[model samples]
Target: MRYVREFKGFAGIRLESDDIGTADDPSIILLHGFGQTRKIWEDVAVGLEQAGRHVINVDLRGHGGSDWPSDARYDFDAYVEDLRAVLGQMRTRPVVVAAMHSGWIATAALAEDAATLASGLILVDPQSESGAQSVRACAEELSASVGQGLAKPDYDERLLDIFDVDGSGARLLDSAPHINIPVLVVRGALGSGHRAENSTGYADAFPNAEAINVDGGGLLVNAERTEAFNGLLIDFLERKQPRFIPEYRSGSDARTLRDAMGCFATGITIITAHDADGKPIGLTANSFTSVSLDPPLLLVCIANNAGSAETLRSAQSFAVNVLQIGQQPVSNLFAGKGEDRFAGTRWEVGEYGAPILPSSLGIFECTRNALHEAGDHFLLVGKVEKASFEPRRDPLLYFRGKYRRLHFT
Candidate 1:
């Protein structure tokens, strides 16, 4: 059975998505390219559902039934944040399947938190980080191809704004290495956006990734070669192990389990709140994810040993500032023991009375709603009161015991 659903995206924009197949089945999330809506994945979703897989097709912000913000922010980070919000609401971590520009969004989102967000990744004819000129040329070509009748009424001309934005290039080169999950890169033989060299580079970057070219297929390989694409997808799914799940058994080595959990890549964040004395307190945390949309809730986990844990737990409000690629030092400073973290860091009090770090990829000013003790950490749930972001910066990442930056192809 198939059903339509709507979810709140970053900044409270409503996103239209379709859910197909049995709820208990393995899930595959499909993302369409620029200027396209979820409709593009209809055929592919049907095929996957027939194979006993649950398929979800989503219309990115400013397309289809989704709301287009007045800010006209159609940059890469906006798309990535939108996907992150959608994934947060899913009952199961899905295998993300993306096309062209959407592939970059998938890569960024997976890079942020692959363990909780996605099981596997499939990138089809994804745009290469070939530079601004190449992106503009591709966008122009796509705009022309859409013509007039083919375009959706809700399609904003600003959807092509990504071409002019800096840092719009795919960060797969840097992010792939951190993504320990299986990845499949599919390119059409004559695809304009994907070049053989770029595909090779992607495969080379990922420790567990492969590239495939579909014969006689063009940009929309899944549509042009539906049967072939479906066959390949099914084959890849069969070969990949089921999604990784943390197994805690009696007598399991705690250190060994911690090492295993580190395999999941995550983006860095500096969670800040004011203490009872009105002193600002902040600490670096990667255990953060959106929890609900009805009330706009998100949660971050703070270890019991963290110096700021008590402050955050008791504060009426806090902010989660997602670190940018240039904020490694800031992450380190907050992560370290005894030094004035905010003394040298550039920051200002947000409207919600939480410290807002400058140049962060995104910021969530939230009101602390609930706190629960889980193991040795405290789960602080917050109802987001304000949200903002920087469109031109890539996220700082942590994976496998090291800091990493996005490598634009």
Candidate 2:
């Protein structure tokens, strides 16, 4: 739930992301029910991502940030069209997931693009016509629990809010046949008696689908029973995968060394200084190591091809600013090739003519003690002219090649 989140979408139609973790394996796309915003699935998405499945929370048209139809009638086809446009904007073509009312609609559209749209599909708790009586019963049972606290609505209100339709029976019957994929129809265990029956009817309608029951769930199963639902969805998506996009970096030329470094965890440091003529020179480096604690000797390596390498190599002194785990933008700027790399960066001069980045986990103002040639890089050793360190913040890491934070806390 505390996952780092962001809002991104068109026409102010907000899309939310809570990266529980990276998606090295399975990716997921989550769709919310009608009248509900994308926030409904935020908790679930974070849980799935933390479990290693890439999860995205989708906002339906006229619901979240998606543009609303000037016309009052918000139907299934309009919802599907919104997804088509949204998918086109996604960084990755995600596995579509529809909860309850959205389940049937998303399934149909995805099946149409089945070949290239997704690596898998996760059909969350959805209602079906064949199971209307059961769902009705389940609805009634749930009505008993929060009847005093919440303003319980009638069947018509429930149907209209969830399916964007006034009627429930005909709607359920028509929607069931639309879902023909290997669906997982999840039902809340604490739901009305009719819900269980409707879920069974739904399972019977879809030949490739299975029915899973999550205890203490209700109409808003994805939100109320988020943990259970997320677990089931992640498990299902991971069970099988299609190599729609075999590589994370599409072409060989676009593959970054950082993607490969994600395998080996390493520490972070920023090396800065002045060249022979006294102009400022610097770059962020994660390949920093302590040579000797006795004399407090340290070393930072710079790649020969790096833009600041020449200036740093010829300098008489340089400062080592060991960064904390969360300084992503700072690392990006220093590692990037741009004229205004330090435009927004906060830094100050050390005793040695070198720039010392603010709030670094540790700062070592040093004079060039030694330089050793490493393959394609130079290891520059520095004798501590001045030193400083902080305890609370953890050291940053550069593994396999991307900047990663220590997640122990």
Clashes of each: 1, 22
Please name the candidate that would achieve the greatest lDDT relative to the true structure: 1
lDDT (tens digit, per residue) of candidate 1 on 207-250: 68888877754454434566777778888986773433457676
* lDDT against the true structure, each candidate: 0.79, 0.62
Q: Name the candidate that leads on TM-score.
A: 2
Root-mean-square deviation of each candidate, in angstroms?
A: 21.6, 8.7
The residue ranges of model 1 lying beyond 4 angstroms of the native Cα positions read: 131-140, 143-154, 162-165, 189-198, 217-224, 241-409
After TM-score superposition, the amount by which residue 171's alpha carbon in candidate 2 deviates from its true location, in angstroms, is 9.2
Writing each residue's lDDT as its tens digit, candidate 2 over 117-156 gives: 6545555556554443333343444455433333533223
Error of 2 at 15 (Å): 16
